[model samples]
Target: MSDGPTDLPAPREAPDAGPYWQAAREDRLVMQNCYGCGTYRFFPSLLCPECGSEEQVWGPCSGRGTIYSLTTVHRAPSPAFRKIVPYTVALIELEEGPRMMTNIVGEGRNEAAIGDAVEVCFEARGTDAKVPQFKLAGA
Candidate 1:
């Protein structure tokens, strides 16, 4: 078993995510908040989904969340992920009010449970892109 997050695919940052990527590279998670509708969004969009408003600002995320649901992949649909099969991919509910799809690292596959407290950690693949991953939080 791996002791840390591994075998992650290279992150492909969105065209408008230069600042967001910069934060992640510094080991911080950043998400966009739409000022118009007061909703948080991931993957960085130009328009707010709740109210179709374009007014938005980027800020640092809390990086604390709970595992909402998870699935273990026994087979990789792509060759790039084949080596890392049987890993847990989860949808975590953030404490700051967003749900993100990310990999649950560190603990065993069965160690992850519904509502497990997790904290965000950054994984850098290169000089430009950094990915956000989750791990079991401390007491």
Candidate 2:
């Protein structure tokens, strides 16, 4: 069986998020860092929220985090996800400080709890893209 849903819709690539997606395809995790203020931000904004600086860089992430919060979906929101009902979605607090929403996959996903350690993994989204997901640390 698949570790997570294979038929889920692909993520739309925003112009500023291109690097993040490309990095995912290469099996690496990255986040936007503001050069002006030395702050990291997610969702890949063009301007740094802290210092309002347009200068930014894509930096590597540790790919390690703790589950800040989570939920188990007992019902699929769409037919494509029906086959994967009962999947877990979690808000992961990355070691670098930003939190990201992603699916918790692989072993122990359903039993995942807040504060559980997790590490990044990639799930193919299509021919050219991959989505970052998480699994229990060491699982």
lDDT of 1 by residue, 1-139 (tens): 2544445466887789887778888898888889997888876788988899998888778999999999887888777568767778899999878899987777554588888899998776654567888888872
Clashing pairs in 2: none
* Candidate 2 C-alpha error for residue 61, in Å: 0.5
Kindly report which residue stretches of model 2 are placed more than 4 angstroms away from their true locations once superposed: none
RMSD of each candidate? 2.2, 1.5
TM-score of 2: 0.94
lDDT of 2: 0.88
Give the clash count for each candidate: 0, 0
lDDT of each: 0.80, 0.88
lDDT of 2 by residue, 1-139 (tens): 1664486778788876988999999999999999999888987898988899999889999999999999888888888678778778899999988999998998877789999999999998756778999999999
Q: In candidate 2, how many Å is residue 53 off?
A: 1.2
